[model samples]
Target chain A: MTAPSRHALVPFVSVDNMMKLVLHIGVERMMTELAAEIEADFLRWPLFDKTPRVASHSEVGVIELMPTSDGETYGFKYVNGHPSNMKKGLQTVTAFGLLADVATGYPLMLSEMTLLTALRTAATSAMAAKWLAPKGTRVMAMIGNGAQAEFQALAFKAVCGIAEVRLYDIDPAATAKCARNLAGRGLNVVSCNSAEQAMEGAQIVTTCTADKQYATILTDNMVGSGVHINAVGGDCPGKTELHRDILLRSGIFVEYPPQTRIEGEIQQLEADHPVTELWQVIAGQAEGRSDARQITLFDSVGFAIEDFSALRYVHSRLKDSGLYQNLDMIADPDDPRDLFGMLLRAGAAQAA
Target chain B: MTAPSRHALVPFVSVDNMMKLVLHIGVERMMTELAAEIEADFLRWPLFDKTPRVASHSEVGVIELMPTSDGETYGFKYVNGHPSNMKKGLQTVTAFGLLADVATGYPLMLSEMTLLTALRTAATSAMAAKWLAPKGTRVMAMIGNGAQAEFQALAFKAVCGIAEVRLYDIDPAATAKCARNLAGRGLNVVSCNSAEQAMEGAQIVTTCTADKQYATILTDNMVGSGVHINAVGGDCPGKTELHRDILLRSGIFVEYPPQTRIEGEIQQLEADHPVTELWQVIAGQAEGRSDARQITLFDSVGFAIEDFSALRYVHSRLKDSGLYQNLDMIADPDDPRDLFGMLLRAGAAQAA
Candidate 1:
């Protein structure tokens, strides 16, 4: 009991440390590990107490809190999106999250999720493709070669066994950066001039554009049968990726249906529009892909549960690697009722 | 701009350091400063984006997230309540919060609020008493002398000119502890055997009992004609402190009506029951303590805006004090699209 109490102090991995840790682990390995965690979590999805992320939207941006508990463990993430942040030399999306012991409601770990988000997004995309894409799916079309593009490309290669990636972005420099980042990764990287060119001869199509407004990066005419569409960027209300006709044609899958109705591609459809939750497919309650010619779309609006899983994975890996620092975030009073005494003792020490 | 960027990299104050800083500042002085900040925030309450807190409830307790923004600044707190936590040598409540820049949506500070909650709750009560309590009110009766008692007593002393506190609790030891904590605070502290006895000759009454159920600590007979009541403990859907009749007899002031309607003493009242927002009173748009003998109730169930104010206050105080460490929580790529490159660089550094 004493040993467990002492071990209860969970180590926190800050953004800088996380970056160093992920780099040490290698991005490809990190993505593979994250995907495995997501898959493991999705298999036990019924054990979770899940809710749609709570959002506070302003004219300029939205701030959200995403919380979930797996009976004994709890997690939450705080994230914000401001499209105009680029003008201020900041990323439009930034986040941090925590994992806690549900039995005691004590936070065990706090982590930076900006990089984790990129990794998890890519991992989730690959996870969906593993079940929905064709058996010999080796080539992926990466649309919107932004901050998350390289991660998506690597996750697919590492998790879904993809050998080639064709990239396109409205910003030519972004596509070039994506290509340069993947220089020695051993995958065939093609920087295309148009989304259509990137889509040609690809088995998987991933759209992760960061436009804040509704933009059709993929149309029904551009999409082909047997292609697994990983829709990653159209995550908030009024922000969408595929044309309506494309969504109508594809067998759309989502993380959480209620959330997907408001934030995913389904937002453009009626509430009654049929969609299969990814957890259901993972849990074997529903089929993922019916045929080789089926057009499958994973409407990948980010969910809190994924962050919870990612945080837990990072915490476990950091513990195993002995690479994290303990954050003195909780007030550990010898006597729980002696909070005031703790304050006074600190004051007395300062005075002396 | 370069200097500011460098300043942003400073280490954050650990929870221990924040406690030390707060203690060094002295509780009374800290509460005084916090009350001023709350007052200033309330004056501009109309500028904020407010929402009811998101709560996840279980049989044992609840975990909640409270978020609010003032167009330029965003803040949120993660808190939990478990009345049985004391039996396990844990606090019935624990919390931490974040302050973020609204323009870029980046978390600027993350600090433990388990201790800060005590201070802010007391300061918020005192701020309300400043507006609603009788002029030069000097005596306060504190019912339920538990974890929050001393802070409440000191805040009233510092903010509302209260010179005496009469404390009472079901447990004689709790009352004794409260008396002992306030020994050197230069106030007349009396331990009372009963709530009615504690209320005698008191100009303001504060109830902060920690029962999880609807337990009435104050009855209509015990509350005097001119006393302003600060109700703190009745902050969840089922928990309440004062009798419904006591609320009907007094003019009720609330922080965020949508929230108070569900968590405050007013939860027992009808949906149409009229209650004045405390901010309106602070703005002079509504009446506060209309007559000399009229009872006033500041139904403080705690609000997100108050947390925002407290976070802002802490950020300002800790900026130059060298009490905080900068958390590398945000991933800032030289080129926003080159996140993968940053990871690669980190990997190279680790290898070297």
Candidate 2:
């Protein structure tokens, strides 16, 4: 009997390998490349098959499956958000994703997305900020300095040319951790005691707290004109960060309106509230940062296409990097229709 | 840094390991046990979160993600069907699946499900037949003798009281392959040239052809009264097996009605076609095989919960069986909020 061919093997990047890959590429350069990949996808957004994530919400948190295809390749991410997990020494969010060939429906790669999600989220935020933030913006504020804070700060510096980042969080240890992690990251990092202090001299304010309730992390009084607000924490139906008044004052931009309406800060507004699709702006079909004093807010609810781009980028990177292992994942018989015969032969091989 | 806790490691069953597992457990006994697990889940169908399988369709075929939860355990299957793949010497259907803790959203097991899906599909069919087929069903006619034919025959012998299987395929080579595989499987196996020839004195007929279009593998006159027809193929939109006249005559039962309307044999019928939910019939909430003259049809599209049960059953079986390897699939930091620190430490450890 012919042995299972190379078709049965799928390359997998585990958490250890993912971290190795990130360190090998250098996080800042990875973020910049991810930003470019995301931008390229956004430019060709019309070619993508988009759908709102299918989520299973429980009392603790939610698990979602986000899938998309760009006609040639298909990708999906399995992600979870359980804010209470942090108290138990577990990440509030965890993820893994897969990329597949559209022609044969074969999985190309599977990778842990906990780190990649952070990179993509920050890259997406920086991409939006590049389009919507005021001209000559150099200072950014990172509120709720948790696991994503350093990634956000580095991504902004790498993608949007931000020179300094001011960090603030409700917990002092989180702020200290963020400050220490960003010590040598090529950016001027400042730790602030209050959210208002973090926003001082900042042209961009990013909120990424791990709160599961409808608490206002960003209010109308705090957001000034011409500053872009990247609201990242509020990504569920009952959980939001920005106030309704802040949403009314800002011209909101979203990855997908159908999803943002149900999960983003705009969930506080009317269902028909006018919001620009970010892809249109990136594709040059709509205006971005129209005037000097325009309050442009990207109410970012993560989308499937961004994950697709990340997976595609990682799959392309596998040729040069040996940080993956081949998994005996697919069952391939010598003759495709003789699956039962293959099983029998496998048993006999074990006996032999 | 502290070592990652056990929760961070997910058990992964590879193809080689799964084949060993099936052989160790004994195939017929495993299928019969799987039928019981499926029956138990079906009995509590209302508790599950059910949705139509999310599919991404290309020109050649389709890839689907099927997810369902019983509020405590969440499971999903990633499966692809490409008829063109067989011509290139690949299985027409290949799959993998995951079972996760709903409370924490951490995957407990990642398994190669191509073999498992075949097991579950055959098991589920035998389960449905056990509830809906006429009394004293000792013989079954399996048309389309391809990959699933032997599995269906064995499952029926183990779950129901079937003692013989008559097989027929459009391609004589496929029938010969199936007959060869099932030669010593403790059942009377017959190979025939035509579907009508195989159906002689058969009480059940199972159609499982691999076609992407609406092809009639089973016509009206070929089906007799009181025979249970298990239609396994034609599971996607614009694909079906039995002719429309047979569907009109048979008392149809389906897994999920909304999904069936788009992808089952009843797709040939009206949108509002009156059909019994198979779970309700199994739970004694509805009737199955009301009379001897009635033709019963299980228009199976394969639901998410059945895969959930299959995964759950597999997980349960993995406890004493050391048939899996731990994958470092989740990133667990000493401090959950310091993911950057974890990556930096990983890099340092590699360098050291």
Looking at model 2, residue A1 earns an lDDT score of 26
Error of 1 at A263 (Å): 2.1
Top-TM-score structure, candidate number: 2
Query: Highest DockQ, which number?
Result: 2
lDDT digits (tens) for residues A23-105 of candidate 2? 99999899999999999999999899999999998999899999999999999999999988888888889999999999999
TM-score of chain B of each: 0.96, 0.98
User: After superposition, which runs of candidate 1 have C-alpha atoms over 4 Å from their true positions?
Assistant: A1-10, B1-11
DockQ-based class of model 1: acceptable
TM-score of each: 0.95, 0.98
Report interface Cα RMSD per prediction.
3.6, 1.5
The residue pairs in collision within model 1 are: B10-B326, B11-B324, B11-B325, B11-B326, B12-B324, B12-B325, B12-B326, B13-B324, B13-B325
Worst 10 residues of 2 chain A by lDDT: A1-10
lDDT of 2 by residue, B107-222 (tens): 99999999999999999999999988999989999999888888899999999989989999999999999989888888999888789999999999999998889899988999
The lDDT leader among the candidates is 2
Model 2, which residues run further than 4 Å from truth? A1-3, B1-4
